[model samples]
Target: MRRSVELEIITEALSKMGPHTPATRLWGRAPDATADMAAEGNVWAGDVHDVALHIVTRLYGRPGTPREASPLAQAEDAKRRRDMGDEIAALTGAHDQLTSAPWYPARPGDLVHVHYEQAGDLPPFGETYIVGHVGAGLMSLQLLAHTLPETVPGLDAEATAAMAGCFAAEAADCPVYEAWFEAGPRSLTIVRDGRPVHIGGAP
Candidate 1:
């Protein structure tokens, strides 16, 4: 499965190479050595909770400077960010769209449907939740729907593996997000409005 996903990513990324070279069409951080991708079985997450880690092609990002900070770090940072360009753009657009929607800045007791973009079939996709607390740019949501890993349609073992990948960053509110081997619910917060978020009314 790891080899398959890696091949898919490499193949798809290389195809888009053309004259416009990409930092890497595939997002997420891997070991510096390409061999580690296989040796360490890094493509798939060990836990069932991380969907993005299961799929190597999952698009996601963390907010902050690049990991490297040496003299050449500037260039490296630019390159790394380029790999995540799509994610950043999507996030910026999500902020714009959500802020404009009736549900923007969701309030406590408000019911809203949060959409999971590009999640294929193995993710939470979209689910209903009651808004909890909102502060410091992080809005707490208490899931209203009875959504368990199994309850999510099409979330089989392989698909479950794809969904379990850790896409969290250092900016994450909790430390569990920092470990790659540790699986969590963290994911690419960016989403496209036009990809069409199937929404529900706020109560």
Candidate 2:
């Protein structure tokens, strides 16, 4: 009943089947072979086929033999491997795309604008920021100016509340907002009201 014993039985059964020419020898023929060689190849093929069928019948048709994992388990394992392969392929594709993309010129003191909905309000507002640093896939920006009014037609109490609420929500879920607040200017992309803004001759 042990797995080793079962394997040994299978091995012994196969060995008793007798050695004849392997299927590989059938293809090892010269261009100008005799009829005898062709007949020998056909005989080898038949022998190999019969041996293969016997092995299959012995493994599956007999009772009281250790069976491999169920078909469902095998299928699930195959699916997991396929899913992992897909994930790896997707990551590789993204990496290749990023590597092949055109470079954008960005640097310190470069002016850029960002826009997002003000908290508690539907209308979005824009803010201008000065780039503090730039690196691969990131740009740090310092707040240079905001739409908040310090003078005439400046942001009222309701507007200020809306802006704060908007930013607060964005800070929680938006990468751009998180970068602005937490990372202090590193971002994957820069946008103004959902539109991409090019800086420093970036196309």
Candidate 3:
């Protein structure tokens, strides 16, 4: 029989009996079992139901069955979990706040990066796009380079110009629609996204 089931049965029997249950452990290899306390560990004690339960739990219970964690250990684990949650929330808020501002006052045909403030299966690095029409405090952006970005590492201008050249012989405007337009769920923060490439009158 499984140790857990046997223990349950033994416990049920002990429950029905008096507190001073005549509990004894015949500790040995089965057939030559003997009522002894010298084999290993405190297998049994005086006539008590608690002692019987402890003996059965130690001897017949599943090996390496983890006992419930102590209160202090549990508290520490909860604190660590709470701390981790706070850290993740802080990181997300920081990212959203950073992306909430436009790098510059963008104009039509300017190269830009469109940021994604929400989580999903998206490009980890921001996508490169070209700013399009602006009307009624809302600006549109066209998908320029998705697979191969127009910008280079360390914001290298010459290398990026070469890469952009490789993408196209000349720059041209593309149409934008609501389907392609990027915005949050609640309200449109068009000015916050679509940051322009030019800085100090240079690309």
Q: Pick the candidate with the highest TM-score.
A: 1
Ranking by lDDT: 2, 3, 1
Tens digits of per-residue lDDT for model 3 on 5-107? 4355665665456444343422223344456545644343343445455655333222134332222333345467786543443334333433443443445
Evaluation by TM-score, superior candidate among 1 and 3: 1
The digit string of per-residue lDDT tens for model 2 on 1-203 reads: 31333344544554455454223122234456655776554433333334544443333222233433222333345467786543443334333433343432434444555544334433545566655544454555456556643322456667664443232221111223332332122123444444555331121
Kindly report which residue stretches of model 2 are placed more than 4 angstroms away from their true locations once superposed: 1-105, 117-122, 133-140, 148-203
TM-score of each: 0.28, 0.26, 0.22
Error of 2 at 58 (Å): 50
C-alpha lDDT of residue 25 in model 2: 22
For model 3, the run of ten residues with the poorest summed lDDT = 179-188
Q: Return the lDDT, model 3, position 58.
A: 36
TM-score of structure candidate 3: 0.22
In model 1, residue pairs whose N, Cα or C atoms come closer than 3 Å (at least 3 residues apart or on different chains), thus clashing, are 50-163, 50-164, 50-165, 51-162, 51-163, 51-164, 53-165, 54-162
Candidate with more favorable, higher lDDT: 1 or 2: 2
Worst 10 contiguous positions by lDDT, candidate 2: 165-174
